[model samples]
Target: MRVALGVSYNGQSYDGWQSQPSGRTVQDQLEKALGKFADQRISTLCAGRTDAGVHGLMQVVHFDTSAERAPYAWVRGTNSFLPRDIAVQWAHVVPDEFHCRASALSRRYAYSLLESPVRPSVDAGRVGWVFQPLDLAAMQAAATRLLGEHDFTSFRASACQALSPVKNLLRIEISRRGAYWRFEFEANAFLHHMIRNIMGCLIVIGQGKQAPEWIDEVLAARSRDAAAPTFSPDGLYFLGPRYDARWGLPDRTPAYDWLP
Candidate 1:
């Protein structure tokens, strides 16, 4: 039987979401806990792979296992062996055809920024910091140009392994509350470093370093060189994927309430 899991983690202690030789990734830790609980080795495939220093509020993964246990048992059992920062939030038995990545209709990400003169101490790794006040009007204008399908090569990392540079960016929502700002993105898919790279450009434009029209020019260039440097990963969070209602999977976890 195939099992789906909703996971959340503070990525500061791990390398990233993917497993590596270092065995310091979120996947590595999750597999280890799952294996221990099942008393057998287990492997998983995730909906998306987040970079180092990026958190995950609701990362979905699926794995096949013969071990018989209740759905809630999978969550409570696996989490017992996991670290404090990482957890299995939910578990469900899924159809054989349900794949965490391939079945995903879209993926969501959120970046939190703290616009303050005082540098972050408590929320250092949880937010991107900017001393200069940002222009909301300019940032909104720039972000509007990024919506819809386009060739996002300018915002992709050089090491990106995606088959195509084109992607459908479904939404880019920007909101602010006091000194905090949140940038929420939903896309059919994303290339490596795409959101971070776009964040860099938006920050530049918001700070008046470039005009909003500059985003259009950058998109037309389709060259990474034409865009600003990739922004910090500290503020990035993988909000998980959206699937059809037929899957009966929870679209959110309690962590969603804690975030902007």
Candidate 2:
């Protein structure tokens, strides 16, 4: 059986989402947990990869099983094996052809303003809280300019393995809630560190270090260093993927709200 799972985590302690040979990683830990809990040597595929220090509020993944498993078996079993930092939020059986990555139509992500030099009592690991204040209005204006399909060469990591720099940015929204600033985006796909780099540029303007309109110059530069700086990984989150009906998971509830 093919299964889809919802997971969330505090990425501060691991290297990243993908398994790595050198340091600890979310994938490696999950695989180990699967071995212990499911007792089936199960492997999983995620909707997207998040870097070390990045969090996930609603990440998705798929795995295969040799025999039928109950919904709670995946949730309860996986949770039992996983460390406290990672949690299996939910699970459902899915079609064999359904993929956590390839079958996704779009993905959404969010980042935060993590710093405050004046009053620094905030949680240390969630968002990229900067010391200085940010101009939320200006940041939102700049974010709106990033919508649409474009070559994000300027913001992608130099080591990014993606074949193309062009991606369809479906939405880029900015909102402020008291001292917290939110940067949310939805796109067909993203290059490695693309969102972080973009956040870096936005923060520069928010702090009045650069003009909001500088987004155009950064995108046109098509170089990693051209943007402000990669924002701290703490504020980033791999939200989830959206799928079409044809690629539906077998046990997906009508409540899954897979559609927008």
Identify the leading candidate in terms of TM-score.
1
**Tens digits of per-residue lDDT for model 1, 145-232:** 9999999999999999999999999999899998999999999999999999999999999999999999999999999999999999
Inter-residue clash pairs, candidate 2: 94-250, 114-128, 114-129, 115-129, 115-130, 127-235
What TM-score would candidate 2 get against the native?
A: 0.91
lDDT of 2 by residue, 1-260 (tens): 88888888889999989989963888888888877876768778899999989887777888887757688887898899898999888887878877888988898888866546763345677767777888878888788778898899998888999999999999987877677777788999999999988888888888898887889888888887778778788778777787887654433323223211
Top lDDT: which candidate number? 1
The reply for model 1, stretches above 4 Å from the true place, is none
The 10 consecutive residues of candidate 2 with the worst lDDT sum are: 251-260
The whole-model lDDT of each prediction reads 0.96, 0.81
